[model samples]
Target: MKFLKYLLIFLAVIIVIIAILAFVAPTEVKVSRSITIDAPRETVWEYVNSLEDMHQWSPWAEKDPDMKLEYRGTEGKVGSVYSWDGDPETVGKGEQEITSIQAPSRIESELRFLTPYESKADAYVQLDETGSGSTRVTYGFESVSPRPMNVLNLFMNMDEMVGPDFEAAMSNLKKLVESGGSSGETQSEMAFR
Candidate 1:
């Protein structure tokens, strides 16, 4: 019984340490993924900047084919928003707005989700010339959780949850830009970015 008591004490100490570490972790977590596309930076930038074009490339939209999506404000400009409501629990409901924009270069947006769980985040996509014909596209999302536990949970699984979407979006962007029109990427990992 003495060994059991010691083990319990050790476990409790470890849990406390983890909770403290989670509290000390950054309140705002920024997750980003980047890839090089064999296309002009401007082409890649144009496709990403337009809220209306997101239906063709966003992974979450692909998850629910019947999701109701709406567009508001002028296309490809600041203040434009893309709102989607999905029946699939995985897809959920969300809105993305262009809070700031600089065409063919950078876009900053406010992302709000209303289903599965309600959350808000700052999203940005940046395009940069990497080589003579290659462009590096970087996508990032930053969110702040009021509770330490929420931050800890997001910290543990965010990369795994969002990385593939970033990869798929980049792949689609690359194919559309390089092909001068559309993509043949049937799945998330089928195309090169």
Candidate 2:
């Protein structure tokens, strides 16, 4: 009886500590990763700007090969959207729509996850010329969790969880762009800056 009482007290103390930590945790999280690709800025931009090509290089796509996908609007234009439904615990159900783009420089989109948990985030890809025929690509996501969800940050390391996926996707993008041969757009035609 003494041991049981002690155990109950210990558990209560632990829960209280966790609740305090969660209450103090940051409500916003951002995860970003970058890679330099040996491809023209425009070529890399073309690939990133196209939703159809995104699935070819995104790490999540490789997570569930059988994941169902739906597309709407034109492929690379603003308003273009891609929706996916898959394992609730793994890929989850989400839709991403291109909200804005600056051609070969930057692309921003709204990402809405609907299952396993519902959350919305801003996803972006920025391309910058790194000289010597290389382009630096930075891909990232930023999310602001509501107050209640902020506690999840105390237990979950957002950067550690999402950073690798971004890195792998960028690596895949580099491979896909460099080995696919030129995009047939000359320097003049490919210039978007």
TM-score top scorer = 2
Tens-place lDDT per residue, model 1, 1-193, is: 9999999999999988878877776677678888888878877776777776655777776778788989899987889889988884678888999899887788899999988888899998898998687889898899887655554764577878787888887776666667666432333443443
TM-score of each: 0.79, 0.82
Model 2 residue 34 CA deviation (Å) reads: 0.3
lDDT of 2 by residue, 1-193 (tens): 9999999999999889767876798999999999998878988987777677777777887788779999999988999999999988779999999999899899999999999888999999999998898899999999998776688887899899988889898887777787663433322232342
lDDT of 1 at 57: 72
Candidate 1, residue 80: the lDDT equals 89
Name the lDDT value of residue 185 in candidate 2: 30
User: Candidate 2: lDDT over CA atoms?
Assistant: 0.84
Reference-based lDDT, each prediction: 0.78, 0.84
lDDT minimum window of 10 residues, candidate 2: 184-193
Instruction: TM-score for candidate 1, please give it.
Output: 0.79
